[model samples]
Target: MSGAPERRTRGRTSPSRLRALDAYLLHCERPLLERQDGPWGEAAFLDVGFGEHPWTTLESARRFRALNPSLRVIGVEADPGRASAAASHEEERTHFRQGGFGWAREAGQPVRLIRAMNILRQYRAEEAGAAHEELGQALLPGGLLVEGSTDGPGGITVAYLLRRGAEGLAREALLFHTDFHQGFAPRLFRDWLPVDWRRRMVPGSALHAFFAAWTAAWAEARAQGADSPADSFHEGARRLSQAWPGVSAEPWLWENGYLRWQPPTEVPRPQGL
Candidate 1:
């Protein structure tokens, strides 16, 4: 089937950046995997928009397979050239296919997770929701859909975790990562918002207010001589959580430079509306 246009970029990803994601998957699947009867039957992970050099795909597959030996990893690329290149690196349990989000349904099995890192950047902002809906339909019940991008040598990343709910697919959390020493910049977070939300990063929007608040807290912490970027980040998260009860400070924020928050459901109205 025809697919979206490819917008490839070169980057490096270290396995350490995925530690928080790994813990989350294990937590979500613990019930089934730890059941007395036995682990769930075979499960699959789809790495969408895996570019020509798919080291991230291979690394993710290896790490996830280590977590659950029964899992299969499939790299899906829209560019035929990239897909062919990815296939050259296939292992016993990992495979590659030339397709896009649409291929999620034709995988011949229910997908437990789909990672679409940096995929949405290739499409216009208006196309994000439709793309998400299409991919959502390809998930197994309770499957996860992680969509986002990384920046600054993969030390800073942002991802939105969505899960198939009874009503439909709902965003579960916003995941953030940064370098422990450098912390994160509010503007950098702005760069990571999903296509649809990127334009809403204006003065009155909640997302805008969120980063503004974070930036203020970060500045305050730095002025107070916080030991490191990690320390400043923790303080910023603390400030945000205190100001908005919806935010939470997670323990993983220290070591992994990760923080998660369940965003408010209401879409922020434009200022002066």
Candidate 2:
């Protein structure tokens, strides 16, 4: 239960960020929509650490509601002032609450999805696993947990999709979003790796080698006069799949600006820390 206290910051929200996540959001929503007749008749989305603006939560609620009117979108904040400020922006099916990841249990109903962006950054790396376990307990069966952070004008972001499994929650995929023009490099994603894995980016590590290959491919594509970032990313993914055939089974499309791969069965822990 111990974690960083909520440190309030400027509320900068963009429609583009929400738009970029549209595809993944839809993918996460499908299952809940299909199971509408279950115990929790209506689907709920909890946007944890939603700042004062809560624009992302508001827009997300509006978009998802368009598909299923019964869906409820709640913006959650740990800072009381920000939560109160967000109240003014609430609409009919969308509301704001004052709490953190712990709010999940208090909901008294199953939650289908929870988005915790930039929330874990404040906590030490050792605290991430505990926070993840806590969040998993708040989900309905087969619920999805999307958590990550972004930087650089909002174009570069990395997110991990953790799906609720029979045992607990397991990381389903690792996603990356980057400005193709800037080219994909290992360093660009270093800051966004989950707290636990951030320090494990070294030789012999799956992620370190993965990014190395991506960077090499990007360089080769650019040298051959690839016109856009998408072109470079496609070439990079192709090279990556060629080197690691397992990648072929996952969604590594260039258009999504994400290279999603199944998480390793056992995540390698950082050594010599």
Candidate 3:
């Protein structure tokens, strides 16, 4: 699902993006929203790193407005084109801006919900932790950050519902396939790290994995040392899993996916430590 564009499209947008959004909404998001907020208290949401297409963000806004006109949504796209496209939608409760995860926090608000699709798949493996932490910091304590990638416009999409900070864990995730047009199904979770940032390596791409490592290391700094971010991360991750075991160690390891790290009671010593 990382290389969502790995698939193709009749138009500029990879068909995966379009299809994935629809499946997630029809099968998952709406019901989840109701359960999470009790009939629609999620009037505010953040799109952490939208690229060229904020189509999903705009569509989400439309649905939220329909569900609760008081709902207000913001799209934070690092790319101007995506922001512009989202802006064009200009619906009753949708808005777009040019920035990264810090956009809203910079403006002073911890979002209730965040969507950071397609961002992780592109990062270098090592940077995953720090990136997750940085992005996680912007969420309200109990808020959710859905992270993952789709194959293309309407192909197959898989994403995880990540919570904010190291203390956050994915409560649920979904997988969708357009070939048969099935709705989203909840994916099991694990306490293991959601991704292996340290293992990500690129041969010829301009993107690098060091960021993933840095982010991850920072996230877990406290767990790694008295002055280490890994140590803190370990503490956060453990607390998260304790709060929700489903996110601890996914029983679905044999499946195509599972949670990454197995958190410890105390800040875990880094693997190498």
lDDT of 3 by residue, 39-123 (tens): 2354367776656666666666656555445666888766666667668866666678877655665776646677776666655
lDDT for every model? 0.68, 0.70, 0.48
Better of 1 and 2 by lDDT: 2
After superposing all C-alphas onto the true structure, candidate 2 shows an RMSD in angstroms of 2.9
The superposed Cα distance between candidate 1 and the true structure at residue 65, in angstroms, equals: 1.9
Clashing pairs in 1: none
Q: TM-score of each candidate?
A: 0.83, 0.86, 0.54
Candidate 1 ranges beyond 4 A from true positions: 1-40, 180-183, 264-273
Question: Roughly what TM-score does model 1 have, to 2 decimal places?
Answer: 0.83
Superposed by TM-score, candidate 1 places the C-alpha of residue 234 at a distance from the truth, in angstroms, of 1.4
Number of clashes recorded per candidate: 0, 0, 54
User: Is 2 or 3 the stronger prediction by TM-score?
Assistant: 2
User: Which candidate number has the best TM-score?
Assistant: 2
Q: Order of candidates by lDDT, top first?
A: 2, 1, 3
